[model samples]
Target: MFNGLSFEKLLLVGVIAVFLLGPDKLPSYAAKLGRLVRTLRDYANGAKVRMKEEMGPEFDDVDWKKLDPRQYDPRRIIREALLDDAPAAAVPVIKPVSRPEPAYLSRQKDAVPSQAHDDSATPFDSEST
Candidate 1:
């Protein structure tokens, strides 16, 4: 059965097909279409059988509708994960231990004169401009 097509729509399509193909070619085309449908059905069934063989008894237990990719929604999944009943374990908060300043920094601070108290003019390079 067509997913949404009514009998009227199908009849219209059939009428158009008959007009397009004419009486001479319609039977052969119809036979080809039937064969194609049969082949597709066989392929689907073969796949299902192969899956059953590979999966063993678990194949029957699987919820096919639930496993369908069309049901997948990232938003719904994220929301469900967020709304899960069990609370997550609290992470331990660690206060960082105070460390002594590095020797190089202390030495640099002592070596560099404070700019607020310094009266020297900054050197400018005229040629580099």
Candidate 2:
């Protein structure tokens, strides 16, 4: 939730808070904010546990551990739901396109160089290419 909080933002917030509360009371104010954040986090976690317990089997299929925003995209969820709702036969069947067979050579001369090619032996002909 607070993963987007950066050092710059934090520093700016701290400066604003200090200005509002005054330097003398800044430490106490920061400590109170810290406690509030911790309390909020604890309450959120408790709520999650309570919600899981209340939902029970209804939400048992859901993987709450993977609830991060990156994995819980709305567009992807809608697309998957749409695909799941569609009847199997309703989707068009696609036959995989077959590849053409490779040509086969049966002659030994063809395996070697043609008559137009030089048969002269070179020092490193095998490695040069």
Candidate 3:
């Protein structure tokens, strides 16, 4: 049931645990860990039971997989968003319109000759004015 952890990683963890705990304490520690896991599992089941009791019959109808954060991936979300069952001809394509230059910039262009326009004059510099 370990989703992300591979067999090699789990084996490495077990080997490290054996080396750190030693042969004498390993069995006792393993027993304690199993008990701890059992206790946590019991707590989770109790919480689920309590939630079902509080939420009534509606909790049974709830979509747990859809609500789960791990169920969503970037690829899945993008795929869902881009999905269109209709024909391509039915979809309208929008063309961008070219906007005219602002009044000040237009006036500046008309007042200044193309050849006389100084390329070295920086727009933002206080010395330019």
Q: Which candidate's TM-score is highest?
A: 1
Clashes of 2: 0
Give stretches of model 2 more than 4 Å off. 1-5, 63-129
Q: Pairing residues by index, what is the TM-score of model 3?
A: 0.51
TM-score per candidate, in order?
A: 0.68, 0.41, 0.51
How does each model score on lDDT? 0.84, 0.75, 0.83
What is the C-alpha lDDT profile of model 3 across 84-105, one tens digit per residue?
6566666677898776666546
lDDT of 3 at 111: 79
* Comparison by lDDT, 2 against 3, better one: 3
Model 2 RMSD in angstroms: 17.3
- The lDDT leader among the candidates is 1
lDDT of 3 at 43: 100
Backbone clash numbers for all candidates listed: 0, 0, 0
**Total residue pair clashes for candidate 3:** 0
